[model samples]
Target: MSTFGKLFRVTTFGESHCKGVGAIIDGAPPGMELTENDIQPQLTRRRPGQSKLTTPRDEKDKVTILSGTEYGITLGTPIGLQVPNLDQRPHDYGEMDIYPRPSHADWTYLQKYGLKASSGGGRASARETIGRVAGGAIAQKYLKLTNNVEIVAFVSSVGKVAMPFVHELEDEEPVSAEFYDMLNNISQEEVDKDITRCPHPETAEKMKETIMQKSAEKDSIGGTVTCVIRNCPVGLGEPCFDKLEAVMAHAMLSIPATKGFEFGSGFQGTKIPGHLHNDAFVRKEDGTLGTKTNNSGGVQGGITNGENIYFRVAFKPAATISKDQETASYDGAWGTLAAKGRHDPCVAPRAVPIVEAMAALVIMDSFLQQQARKASAALLPSVEIHHSLLGVPPKK
Candidate 1:
């Protein structure tokens, strides 16, 4: 199904080469203040041609709201949003009609649908993510107001450049002008700016030089993104069927090029013994039990533990590159096709917003689920309280 969610529903539409693509969001709460301005920054971040390392395709990615609001606030109705296609190169993809790009959806799409968008991979294009990003921004606003939860994701790796380990940034703190100053002050022409977007000048310079050289050679590469969620309330998930992390992984894997995802210790935990990997219980100043180490990544028993949750997503290289390669056409004839389009040498930079959007969606969904569960529990005659869990009062 193209739709997601039980309470805050999101349904996406349109194709990459179509006039435009958009989404309709239903079940958004009323009176939660929102504006087109709030959604623009995210769309801009995902827009094409934002930097030298990304595709040269220029798109303004302007969003228009068609319904579900009067003035600026949402009406608690289905919200409709549209993004017009400003820069389309339909002719540029004519060759692709016969020869599909490797590692892309071209061949599989034709196999499944018997037809594919002649230009820009249509529905499969990363352009389709505009709806996701816009819808996610709304979810994020709601999540912030309800739980004060914050989600931040940045480039953690690009090609070979890996960022040194650093404490995750807090979400409650607003990114100040100083932060913008730091980003603007970066001297490298390429956007990777060190695998982690860490703003280390020397590393950024080398990272840029490397991407430029690769771009010039008509090759493409991929990397990883690490997302951190903070201040999320406890008891925010339904276990077994709808585990929080599983829902999150499903949403993330739906992205165009994501290849892998792991929460908490993930695969690295396998190397450590049970004692070393476990999160030890400790008494906080408030006398609440907390984990001294976050090896669990906040979620225990498929529920939030009121600790910072972090994970990593690995993105595969952009498949469309300038170099020639051998491939079979729709008629099963062996041939050569060189990618000819404005494409990114590395997609890691542009993917940051995409990752953040999915992360917000997961957290928001989990928070809503928590509310539903609490409401259901309140309806019961008796309840049980646990000393291990935070938030809420003991059952009376």
Candidate 2:
């Protein structure tokens, strides 16, 4: 479970309060410009204490490129990356050596392993995602440079506060050119404009206030993040088992606090009939066959259709709250415990980058798989078989 992706695969290691945490990325092409500079930005974005709403851990999360590069270019080998833990206070969690936090992975980890870390959630900590963010940065750079793919995720809701829908497309028509413009070209700078990172200024303000209020009350809240993957090539996914959306959901739900995932019309699409839910094929201005409606998101029949792919992930509130709660200990002892640790009052804001990182991982793997399929199909020249097997047009 610690490893993710296939070809461009990533295996993340280390723990929350350990000396460091990082990832080893394999299958990257040689001679690509790579360095600490490319990875640090995403780590900083995912780090704690960026705002008062998040945990006040204050980790710099400075990453180091330990291997797989020389003179700032990749060597087509396994890349080893590390980020140190600068502000670890494991002693603060001594109370948890005996009693686990309610709703946290503490008990689960112990139950599975027969023992657990002395402090922090160990591998289950959000810090573990540091490696993912770093590795995903590489994937993002490659996808952007090669396919012009743009992946952006933002806080769509915090607690009960939510932004006004960015786009409310009708079933009769596809996403407008205006929406593609806004969604495709959106920058992380815009999403980070507010403390809550909700994109909508008014809603961001409300979300921040709600988070502050909850933190003050020693409570927490759950919310949602919306992500968009624009300018993706068509035909990325296995038709039978690894449907594009299914793999996407697998990736998103793997996140620590993620509770739910929905893409395209998702659950709401069920409200409409088959005709209305379907995305009709039409010709784009570029002469490529496209969808007149995009209720299928950007994928049809488990494959991408060269349109914007969008999804939403719901996050449960951080389980470690400062408020006291009664729960069972490892030995079946029941007592009141007020969790002692730094945790987000609402996870949506910091989770924005993680959502993007996970999305990048998925897209990167899909892109590589598609590339492999296309390359192998080139040697076989039966026209009918080629068309059937290589459903997507060859890369121009």
Top-TM-score candidate index? 2
Task: Estimate, for each residue in 85-173, the C-alpha lDDT of model 1 and write its tens digit.
Answer: 97887888877977889989998888898888888877778888899899989987888788777776766566777654422323322
Estimated TM-score per prediction? 0.88, 0.93
Clashes of 1: 0
- Report the poorest 10 consecutive residues by lDDT, candidate 2: 166-175
For 1-396, candidate 2 gives per-residue lDDT tens digits of 889988988899999999999999998889899989999989989999887888999899999999999999999999999999989999879889768888888888887998898899899899999988998999999999999989999888887677654434455333355544557677789988887877788888888888889999999999999899988988898797899999999999999998999888777676667876687789889988998767688988899988889888999999889998888776789888887889899998898999999999999999899999989988887565454465776655
Cα RMSD for candidates in order? 6.0, 3.3
Candidate 2 backbone collisions, by pair: none
Best by lDDT: 2
Alpha-carbon local distance difference test for all models: 0.77, 0.87
The parts of candidate 1 lying over 4 Å away from their true place are 166-202, 381-396
